[model samples]
Target: MKRISRREVLKTTSHFFVGAIAGAGLNSVLQGCADTSSDQSAIDDIMKKTEMADIKNIKLTVLYDNVLYKKEMATYWGFSCAVQGLDKNILFDTGMYENTLMSNMLKLGIDPSKIDELVISHDHPDHVGGAMMFLENSSDINVSLVKSFGSSFKKEVKERGLNLREIDQPCLITKNSFSTGEMKNFTKNEHALVIRTNKGSIIITGCAHPGVVEIVEQTKKITNEDVLLVMGGFHIMNDLGTKTKKIVHRLKDLGVNFIAPSHCTGGEAIEIFSKAYGPKFINSGVGRIITANDFI
Candidate 1:
């Protein structure tokens, strides 16, 4: 596992974010702890007998519909995330097609073989373009392909015998989930999807393009935690005045509670992250349904 060179892994991940900003900004500390509240009914009464894993009842369906879905065309956006479960139904990125993402996952009834897992965050095509029509309509849905543009698409992803894994680092996928591999690349091949939830860390990205605050400071420096929720795309469209309010006050001084932001995250940068995270911001498209029990 000494194959570095992706331009020296983006210069050693930008020198580990400039030596973690003089030893404390390891993307600005988090050390596990996140309940980024708008007080979801007091976090639903402290997770009300929390032990969520087999997805008791969850749903986030948006097969693919650009223009950030709404908010009046929000300066043209793009993203496709479909997450539903009672027992493993996931489809992170697959917009752009698949018959309009299987007629918007059959108008959100979602039965692409109960969609086990299909994470393709990079290799754009509006995020793996409906992932080969969800493997041509569920070939026993068990996909895990997460490689970013290399090995030349691995022979049509190994002739669709997929279950591929080209993730270069950071692991776990089920079991307090994680996956930030092949990141720090800047141009393409970017990655992000860590979900450790007992109260913190629920990062998910698609168009971050390497710097969504450096991919949530490299997933809290590879899981030190507390980054409650950092939805998607903060590519900061053309940095308007005061550098987008100092990048939303440096993501609220790195205590990032919640900031949905879809597609290229424009529309005046979601109105400067809704006036610098006023209500802890929210607006992720395609039938939103974000949960956090530490991603079970």
Candidate 2:
């Protein structure tokens, strides 16, 4: 495994979740349905949904996990992200192993009780695998664990007396944060986090099995803000020479400013991004910390 810093690992997994690969199985369903031509009108609508002044001092920290680092992280860890501020600490996804996630959080100085909310990106083990551990850590607080499905994990949560909200409908978590709520339109029952930030809306995804492109476009539809940063697994590593280039161009055309592709993103894709985005492309790894403050 590459010697990735903890901060790098954290930011890469800021959007950790399980999703299907685009053009692999669900491409036809996603491609034929939406007219890309209408994207401009949609952008306009998104801009109209909120005022720029509404965004404030929101800070996100790449907390724990591995898949976001591209290399099969040491097997001691999985993929997990910690979001701080906004009056709540929302943990997006948990890695495959509970011990690794817990130890990483401890080494990184994150307390589970400080986490006000827990959101699951999908049903995959890597994403929700550490839920029971998280709940066990925060037994004192009425922490809210949100997910689209009433996963068997729900039983574990309820059995432990943790508050679990099986979200079937889209709902707001904070002043400007929104959840995709299972994203039944796509496979893997994946969900992503859309956060309003000072620069613009930051969309955090896990695995992006539903298609990274589709995730970004859907976030634009829901939040109506120019995506400032998209950091997480793109699940597109097979052909970096051509496909990554196309995706980068599309993201540019869509007005995305920063991208930190990790986890399932192969080396070739990382190379393409490093050449294309340069400094804007972050190198993520376990034990590293990244935030908007660090950017400025």
Candidate 3:
């Protein structure tokens, strides 16, 4: 095995979105011969059978982000969140800079060694920057990411003796959580985390390249539950005018009760979401914590 630089990793991953578009087309061709409905039915049955503990509270701490809620915390062009109070302590994505991510995590008292699983939303450098650092600290953790992740990235995980699970379709990540699977549009391949609670389901995304509304719909299809909250990067920074507003309406129509847009979601888009969601719109940034009870 050979060591690869972060720059090389970034270079390789830069091709993912374009490749994903091509791959998605091929997948459609292949699925044309298969019974997609049966597959979906099986997934629904599995989702129904998945048992979750009666979670009274779920805590999500923003470990890395482009925005800062606490002045002492570091902010960067990336995203990461620490999810606790569930079946497993999951670390979602790793912000772009290793030192910054570790510093923020340390300031927040979040130990990477305690993470039961690491769910990466994609292979972008910002989303995966601290992955190697986290892997160095934790020995017994499972890593989940889209199956379309670059080979160099996968090789790094294998070389580090990390347990890696490649996700292609909606699958149960834990007793109470399911990944919305790999969703691709024109930009990148990403997956949103879906956690089912007594109140409803929560969707956590990283740079929603497939459209946030589509991600929510996919989660709904798998969990068959109303979305209690939809948080994370919406990737709508460049969308001017009525586009962002239409997306907000689409999410509302899909039964999304709350919104917390961060990172690449842009200031304008966040403002739009803030006005639309009103009190339900959470101010998310580094060190921001949201619990399950907050939704209720």
Clash totals, every prediction = 5, 22, 0
| Ranking of predictions according to TM-score | 3, 2, 1
Scored by CA lDDT, what does every candidate get? 0.57, 0.60, 0.77
lDDT of 3 at 22: 17
22 Cα displacement, candidate 3 (Å) = 35
Model 1 lDDT per residue over 168-284, tens place:
555444544556555656477677766655456667787887777777777776655577677766666776746668767776777778777766766788787877786667766
lDDT of 1 at 242: 68
TM accuracy, model 2: 0.73
Q: Pick the candidate with the highest TM-score.
A: 3
lDDT of 3 by residue, 73-113 (tens): 98989999998888788999988877898898899999877
Listed in order, each prediction's TM-score against the native is: 0.29, 0.73, 0.87
Candidate 2 lDDT by residue in tens digits, 179-215: 6544554546576777777687787777777777878
The better candidate by lDDT, 1 or 3, is: 3
